[model samples]
Structures are given as C-alpha cells and as structure tokens.
Target: MTTDSTRRTPLVRLRSDGAVDEATLAYARTKIDAVLARPGLPAVTGEVRITRAAAHHAGHPWAATADVRVGRRQVVAVAEEATGTELVDRLQDRLRRQTDKAAHYWDDGRGTTAPPWRGGELRDGVSP
Candidate 1:
C-alpha cells in the first residue's frame, strides 16, 4: 500500500470496506463512538478503512485510514503497522488531534456572541 498521506473522503461507503475483520471493525466503531460522545464536540460523521498488504510490503502490512468530519472540518489520517491494535491506536490518536484542533478553532469565541475570555474558559481546558 502507498505510504503517502492522501486527504480526501473515501469513495467507498463507510463500514462497507471489505478487508477489515469484525473485531477490528468493532474496535473502530467504539473509538468513533467515544469521540462523538464528547460533550463539547460538534456533530460528526466518519469512516475507517483497514487493508492488509502482501508480503512484499515487509514489516508494515496493515494500513488503516480514518476519515472524519467535525462540523465543517475534515480530518484524514493514514498509518501502517504490523498489528490491528496498533493501527487503530494510531488512527484514534490522529483523529483526536484533528478534532481537538477543530474544536479549538470553532470554540475560539470569535464565532459566538460571548467574549473571548468566556469562550476560552468554557472549554474545560480543551483549547489549543
């Protein structure tokens, strides 16, 4: 699989990718659910695609991509690892970073009527 970071929506449907196993898919779903449950986070939609490569790919045969949308922001992260758990962890980390940034940007107080100090204080220390 290609190692380059390609940032775009997946052409295939979310949860429709063929290669991911049931356990891994479940793990990804749980992770997505946790992110969505965050109180200050915006509305989101997301997908995960994990592909296992041939022997020619060497040490990193498992590649995973997570595409997520929070409000008007889109975050995409691609990673390759030797195991499914590691791949999921990396994807979750990347997605968290992206969403955190979006939350910070949108919560900057500029977009709302509240003063900047009030908005900054409201985030429960999630601001960037």
Candidate 2:
C-alpha cells in the first residue's frame, strides 16, 4: 500500500465468490471507515475482501479479511459470522483491538501510522 498521506485514501477491495452484492460492499465500506475515523487513529488505506464460507460456520455466513496499509506498515484483520448481522458489529470490534495494539509501534507518537502488508497474509487466519 502506498502512504504519501497526501494521496487519496485507497478504496477497500470487496471480494466474494458471487455471494455479496453492491449494497453489502457499500455498507462494509461505511462501517469500516467509521471505525478507522476514531480519534488518535492512523490514516488507513487498502482493500477488504469478504468471502462466503462453506456452509459450516455459525453466526455469519460471510467472512471478511481486511488488508490495510496505514503509513508504511500493513495490518490485516479477518472475521467470520454464519449469519448476516452488522458487518462492523461482529468484525470491527476485533479489528479495533488489533489497531490499538499495533498503534504501540507508531512513529508519530499519536498512533498515526500505516498498516504493514507483511506479504499479503491474513493476520487472523494463519496458524501459529
């Protein structure tokens, strides 16, 4: 992700196996932008991919993974629910926590930094 700070914030990339629609994508962007707008948070850029999991999950039928590039760092957040609820409600809560954690490494001292890409990997789904 590019981090000029002056450039336009990159659009969130919504990816699905033909399971999500334009409305859902729009809503996701709204909710995500709202979360990143919190005070003292870093300016974020990148894409969010939402995929429909095979019919075996619970809570939400959709699963989302965000690849955010803050300043020079990239941070990824992933969540899934077997049902359709507030995308931000089920996902942003956890994502917010992650942003908070990564904020500790910010260079601006005000938690204003970019998310790290780290080779395009999802931070939530990888096995340790």
Candidate 3:
C-alpha cells in the first residue's frame, strides 16, 4: 500500500457555491487514489470539482465531477448525493466504471463507446 505522499495528488476544487469540509476533501482524495490503483491505469492525473447547491433541498444537493486521465484517454463522471460522503462514494463508483471502459477501449482493443457527455470536447462540439 502506498502512502499519500507517494501517490500523485489529485487537483480538487471546491466550488464557491458552498464550502466543503476538510474531512470530505481528504476522503475524496483517498477515493481518487483507489480508483487510480486499478490495472491499466498506471499513470493518472486529474481533477475533481465538488459543488454544493446554494439553496436548501429535500433530496441530494451535492454534486461531484471527476476528470481522470488514464494513459492517452480520459474518463469523466458526475454524481449527486444528499450528503458529502454519499457524493464521494457515488463519484468513486462512476469513476470505476468510466475508467474500466477507457482502459478497455485503449488497452484491450474493445470498442467502448463513451456517453455523449463524457468528453468535454465531444460535448462542446456537438450541435443540435
């Protein structure tokens, strides 16, 4: 097991809409590390942006967006949850799936088609 100092740091940004506690940030970093540990993701550097809804909500109000670079490909996922911990967990789940697909597409020659909104360029380039 590698210590925090040994792992590549993830760039995390807490949106100005709301503040995120230190504990939550630490937890998110750990989750990112776990996601990067999977096979075929030898070198990953990415960013995680977490935002909390400004208004009070009855349901999930926190959102997390992750952009991870695995090899020559990138994997992105977004998730929302009622609590900070839940938000992190959901983001981790999404990252795992996205990373798997990216790895398969780049390493295993599998035709893994990403979601329409996964890549930022793809999303920006599309016109309705």
CA-lDDT, candidates in order = 0.64, 0.61, 0.70
| Reference-based TM-score of each model | 0.65, 0.60, 0.67
Model 3 error, position 100 (Å): 1.3
Q: What tens digits encode model 3's per-residue C-alpha lDDT throughout 8-35?
A: 4534332323666767767877887777
Which ten contiguous residues of candidate 2 have the minimum total lDDT?
A: 1-10
Tens digits of lDDT, candidate 1, 2-68: 2222223222223423345667756765665565557887766666667776565579877877777
* By lDDT: ranked, best first: 3, 1, 2
List the pairs of residues colliding in candidate 1: none
Top candidate, metric TM-score: 3
Q: 18-69, model 2: which lDDT tens digit per residue?
A: 3566566566666776766567766666776666655663456777777776
- Deviating ranges (above 4 Å) for candidate 3: 1-17, 107-128
